[model samples]
Target: MTLSFKSLGLSEACVAHLDHLDFKTPTPIQAQAIPHLLSGRDVVGRAQTGTGKTAAFALPMLEQIDVGDRSLQALVLTPTRELALQVYQAIQLFNTDRRLQILTVYGGQSVERQVSRLRKGVQMVVGTPGRVLDLLGRGDLKLDKLNWLVLDEADEMLNMGFIKDVETILNQAPAERQTAFFSATMDPVIRELSAKFLRSPVTVTIDQPKAAPNRINQVAYLIPKGWTKARALQPILELEDPESALIFVRTRRAAAELTRQLQAAGHSVDEYHGDLSQSQRERLLLRFRQRQVRWVVATDIAARGLHVEDLTHVINYDLPDSLESYVHRIGRTGRAGKEGIAISLVHPLDKRKLRDIERHIRQKLEWGTIPTRAEIEARYIDKLKSRVQEALTGERMASFLPIVSQLSEEFEPRMIAAAALQMAYDQTRPSWMRVEPEATDDDRRPSRPSGGGSRTPQTKSRRPKINRVSEPSSPSRS
Candidate 1:
């Protein structure tokens, strides 16, 4: 038997709103964590990002808010501004009754505007740690009436070096408030933080089955000793021909460089990272959702909170440093019981990291070889054949028959058909296949190169010195 939100003892109003949003059955995290949260118990929920953990905590928190008082009754802290906005929007959808005033605070936006809204008395606040702490320090944000405190994506906060800021905010909040800590992984630091903060919290962990979810076909291609990942990625993309993909890279520079290279190769790709402005991010997201872009190259920080429906594949162009990050990256796909693909490009040096990921996910990644040129051509021909078969059965075939007949009078009927098919195939072929450039020594450069230009003896181009600036201990809301 399947369990529904109504069966979980949620208020009829909440159930009705959920039904209106077409959310009928409860996900495992929601089913397990919602009850304890509604009962005013601190909860430690361990689940992947796309497992509906946001609603698990948000829905119940919404139910307990004292809308009449209009004091900030609930506070939700997130690691990134993207997630902060996402959570705020999700809560608004659940706020069908319009009983609670909700506000989202983050960096990169006008602080004065947020301060103005806070003065107007919002019942709930969702924000990144830095912005939340800043408002707290200014005495503009009060938690005296706060009844609930939620630390969403706690592990990610630690990764972003915001744990100290999170601790400060937690210490400042009312000690009696209900606290919830949600994370994708339970490393020692997270466990210690939960122990220090949550008061005898009921722990709810939703572990993925030992076997990899059947819906996701996990595969990895070992990069050959002489080839760069960028060189290897082209053949994989051609073979898979993903309708939409999220390509995960390790750094902002990598994301930009990869996006540039893919674009230069005439692929519909774009970059998403902290360097983009809020409006640029929103525009790119819209394009991606609308399928204008085939793939997006992004770092982990920028990719958080991004959800796309029917995402065909997740390409780990650069394997993440941790198993948790790998799980989270692939979790973007294979959502809502839909089958998806996760492809990773692994170098020989990173085999140990790949093994660690396999151990963590409880399944070994299937080894995949880069598709040969002949194989890619065969796939393309197979697609062309399917299209030709469809055209033969369609009404449009009759319209073109007269023209074919005229050509058949001068040439063999089979020859005319072959010519037409060749034309159609050429039109649909990928740009890379149409123009194969000869390989050069420069192509073997593992890292991004400086601009191309002839240099004099006195004017040789040199790699720019990268000054590593130490990030402040305070968290970044952006």
Candidate 2:
């Protein structure tokens, strides 16, 4: 059955909000969990990223919120700054009609700004574990009035060593408050968290029978450490002819460097990393979504919850540290049953991690051929042709007709197109580009796991409760 929010018992206002956002049907997670969650029951939602889990919880939580109240009603704790921003955006979309105020507090920023926003009275707070606990410790924020508490990406929190902090924050909250726990995997630690904290919570798991999405064809390249990974990337990208591709690197520095190289090599490209401002990140994403950019080189921390529907390829510029990270990285593509590809540039050092991932997922990935120079050139020519066709069909071509006619008087029409293509390609390549040998361990990898390593499950002595405190709101909306 095609599911609608109205049938799921959402208010007309919230339903209208969903409709405006073009959310016509329920994702699997929403179909099963919304009703139970709306009933104010605690829920352990086991769903991967890209399964629309954010809306599954956000919609119901918004419905439960009192618009006239101006207290910390809902507190969403995420593992990374990227996720906190994503959840905040989701909340913003839902509350657009109601104009509810939502604030995000995370580290790597000024605490005073968060405090100032808190003083203005926000109904929802989306933040990372470190910052949330900091606020709680300083008494700058209160969870006493929190109505709904969400521990998003719960397993990731545990892996990031934020489990104790999560417990601490939850302990400060009232025992009677509604709670929701969402994680991509049902690891032992996550299962224990649900058992300890949830009050007979409704469980929702929307993992498809397939571990990886069927629409994505996964393959790996066996490149040695001393080989040119940038040169390696060029042919793969050329062969794919992706409208917009996301290249995943392990660190901010690598992402920046690769982005610069790709751009210098005559590709329409940009880079995203933790070092970029939130506004800059949003602008880059907007451009990618609008198809105004060709490629985005990014790190896992910067690219979390990056949903670009038309993304055709996801390249593991560097191997992810864990199976979960690999899953999420590739999951960026092959979305919504669209055909996509995930290519990993694997070195000898990555063999163990790759094997572990394949073992964990219970499937051996297919080996694929890397494109040769001749093949790359042929594919580039084909891409140039496609771009020329697109350019000629648009209304803007009228302005170029005179130049085309002048060139055609001496050369063939195709010759003119070729010249234009070469000019376009030359103008867009990166500036600081150097075709050096592939990265060494000291150059590409972090000193530690970079929050990408897995850990054994550990138990805590007690479960902490999230408190709910509701304060009356002033009649006027700020």
CA lDDT scores, all candidates in order: 0.83, 0.76
Best by lDDT: 1
For residues 388-467, write the lDDT of model 1, one tens digit per residue: 89988999888888898888889999998888888888888766566554554443313211222211111222211111
Ten-residue stretch with the least lDDT total in model 2 = 463-472
* Candidate 2, residue 295: lDDT: 88
Model 1 bad stretches (over 4 Å): 389-402, 405-409, 435-478
TM-score of each: 0.86, 0.78
Backbone clash numbers for all candidates listed: 0, 18
Q: Taking the tens digit of each residue's C-alpha lDDT, what string does model 2 give over 201-303? A: 9888886877777777777776534545665566566567678788887777777667766665567889887788867877898898898998898877678
Model 2 stretches with alpha carbons more than 4 Å out: 224-226, 274-293, 348-364, 387-478
Candidate 1 C-alpha error for residue 332, in Å: 1.0
User: Top TM-score: which candidate number?
Assistant: 1
